[model samples]
Target: MASIFTKIVKGEIPCYKIAEDDNYLAFLDVNPNAKGHTLCIPKQEINKIFDMEEDHYLGLMQFSRKIAKALEKTINCKRVGVAVVGLEVPHVHVHLIPLHDMDDMRFQRKVSLAQEEFEAIAKEISKNL
Candidate 1:
C-alpha cells in the first residue's frame, strides 16, 4: 500500500498545494498548528528522513527552506519552526509551522480553518514562492 503522502502526490488524494517540483511537493497541512503550517516531502515516499540519500536529504531541506520563507511572508508569525516526527505517517515529512510563540510548535494544540481559507492561504504562499 502507498503512504498517504504518495497518494497525494499521485493525485489519489486531494491537497491544498503550495509548490511542487519533479522531486518534491509542498502543501498546507489540513490539520495545522498554525494558519500557514505546511508539509514538505519528497515524492519518492521514503519512510524515514535519515534513510534518504545525502543529496535527497539536502534537497528536502533546501525545498523546505523555500517554503518556510514563503510561509514567513504569507503568514503572520515571529518565525517558521520546523519539525520532523515520522511516527504519525510512514513518510519523510518536514513540518513548516508559523510560530507566534513556543506553544505553536507543540502539536498538542491545533488550529482549524475552513476550506476557502485553506485555498486562499495556499494561494498566498504559492504566490510568495
Candidate 2:
C-alpha cells in the first residue's frame, strides 16, 4: 500500500505544491505549525530518513535546502527551522518551518488556513524557487 505522501506524489491526493524535481516534492502542510510550514519528501516513499542510502539522504537534504531558501523569501519570519520526526507519517519528511519564536517548531501549536490561502502561499513560494 502506498503512503499518503506517495499518494500525493502520484496525484491520488491533492497538495498545495511549492516545488518539485525528479527525486523530491515540496508542499504546504495542511495542518501547519506556522502559516508557511512546508514538508519536503522523496518522490519514492522511504519510511525512515536514516534508512535511506547515504546519497539518497543527502539528496533529500539538498532538495529541502532549496525549498527552505524559497520559504525564507516568501514568508515573514525570524528564520526557517528544519525538523525530521518521522513518527507522524510513515514517509520520511523534512519540515521547513518559518519561525518567529521557539513555539513555531514545537508541533504543539498549529495554524488554520483556507484553501485559497493555501493556494496563494504555495504559488508565492513556487515563484521564489
Candidate 3:
C-alpha cells in the first residue's frame, strides 16, 4: 500500500506544496502546529529515518534544512523547530514548525488553517526558498 506521503507525491491527493526536488517534497501541514508548520518527506517511501541509506538520509536533511531556512524567512516566529516522530504514518517525515515558545513544538497543541491560508503560506515559503 502507498503511504499518504507517496499518494501526495504521486498526485493521488492534493497538497499545499512548499518545495520539491527529484528525491524530496515539502508541503504545509493541514493540521499545523503554527502558521508555517510544514512536513518534509522523501519521495521514496521509507518506513524509518534510520532505515534510509546514509546519502538518502542526508539528502532529506539537506532538503529539510532548505525548507526550514525559508520558513524562518517567511514566517513571523522566533525560529523553526524540527521533529521526527514517524508513529502515525508508516513513511518517514520531518516536521518543520515555526516556534513562538516551548508549547509551539509540543504536539498537544495544533492550529487550523483555511484552504486559502494554507495555499498562501505554502506559496510564501516557496517564494523564500
Residue 2 Cα positional deviation in candidate 1, in Å, after optimal superposition: 0.6
List TM-score per model, in order.
0.99, 0.98, 0.98
Per-candidate alpha-carbon RMSD to the true structure: 0.5, 0.6, 0.6
Residues 25-79, candidate 2: write the lDDT tens digits. 9999999999999999999889999999999899999999999999999999999
* lDDT, candidate 2, at 106: 93
How many pairs of residues in model 1 come into backbone collision?
A: 0
What lDDT score is found at residue 92 in candidate 2?
96
Over 4 Å off, model 1: none
Worst 10 residues of 1 by lDDT: 100-109
The sequence of per-residue lDDT tens digits that candidate 3 reaches over residues 22-124 is 9999999888889999999999999999999999999999999999999999999999999999998999999999999999998889998899999999999
For all candidates in order, the CA lDDT equals: 0.96, 0.96, 0.95
Model 2 worst lDDT window (10 residues): 42-51
lDDT rank, highest first?
Answer: 1, 2, 3
Model 1 agreement with the true structure over 38-121: per-residue lDDT tens digits: 999999989999999999999999999999999999998999999999999899999999999999989989999999999999
